[model samples]
Target: MTAAQYLNCLQGVMQREWLRFFQQRSRFLSALVRPLLWLLVFAAGFRAALGVSIIPPYSTYITYETYILPGLCCMILLFNGMQGSLSMVYDREMGSMRVLLMSPLPRPFLLLCKLLATALVSLIQVYAFLAIAWCFDIRPPLWGLLAAAPALLLAALLLSSLGLLLSNGIRQLENFAGVMNFVIFPLFFLSSALYPLWKMRESSEWLYWLCALNPFTHAVELVRFALYQQFNLTALLVCLGLWLLFSLAAVLTFNPQRAAVRG
Candidate 1:
């Protein structure tokens, strides 16, 4: 397809995907509510109970609720990306994705547009959560707000690609529960989302190493740094690299013939 044609197809698919989220009001509200509940209720309780040492991006003692805001925001984007990709699989079975795939644009480009659309929706939800956190006085640097955009987008991209990879592999919703249980919680808890690597060190050096290796750790750190209006080259590289890798995997898994067999 010509460049203009490709751009048109991308825009069209994005609009369709965005409209899908709006039409499913319950789904959108539920997505927003889950993260808000975590930030407000669970994190509030934890803030009183837990003691966190000062870490990079945090200059002094901080409430647990304040500390986990970025992580919870990341969680919202992460889970929403998975949910959106799962919906794509359901749409494929229902023949909607087939209609999307039949567009004149290149197949990979079309599929990527879907991923971008999901990422956009997920990113917005995260920012909404951030706004609420600010209201609660869990403030990050004002400049962090603007710096967060790219990091948030990259996190959404990585998660969305992982979701696409899963949907491309698992043909039925029935099979998703186990993977979600096994993958999602472990990735979240094992990372620096809830605690610092130094804290994890007191528990197990191996656990600390594992968190260091986790791409999600870098994602959290990227946002944490951005929240302080600072940048970390290592964290940036990790997020960018993982995003590229997962996006390639998603594209490979969605290839027409390959997708058919998996379905």
Candidate 2:
């Protein structure tokens, strides 16, 4: 296909995915609600219970709610990425994914189209969550809101590539829930999401390094810095590197004959 034709097909698939996402009201609302609940109810109740030190990018005492908004946004991308991949797995079982895989187009491009579609959906949910955060007086600078766009796009690619890795690895859907719980929870908590690396260092040097080493931590930091209208070079580089690496890995593993010869 010509470049325009290929792009048009990509757009068509993405539009279909978006339409289907909206049609499922529960899925749509759940995406918005989870982050809101964490920001409003969960963070509010725990704001005073947790004492935090002044970390870079933060001055005097800040509420926990304000601190974790970016983290919660990361959570939305993380969950939505995996959820989208799970949907793909279900489609495969129902014979739809096979048709998708067999499309008269490059397999990697098709997979990327799906990933981009999922990223768009994830970004919508994140922006909605950010709007709700504004109502509660939990917001970053205006520039942060603008900078968050690319940060989120990178995060989506990182998480979506992870989802692609998982979907291609795990042939069964029933096993996904356990993987989600194990992977998502640890990745979120162990990172500098709710706390700073320095804070984690005070608790445990090991924990501090672990957080520093985690790519998600970089993803969160990139968003956090962008939220404050500051550019974090290291965070940006780390996130970009991981996005490229994971996406390449996902494409490699998704090849039909990678493991066996075709008949």
By lDDT, the best candidate is 2
How many clashes in candidate 2?
0
Residues 98-172 of candidate 1 have per-residue lDDT tens digits of 677667677778778988999999888888778887898888878889888988888888888888888878767
Off by over 4 Å in 1: 255-263
Q: Lowest lDDT 10-mer window, candidate 2?
A: 254-263
The CA lDDT at 37 in model 1 is 88
State model 2's lDDT.
0.84
Error of 2 at 160 (Å): 0.7
In model 1, the Cα lDDT at residue 60 comes to 88
Number of the predicted model whose TM-score against the real structure is largest? 1
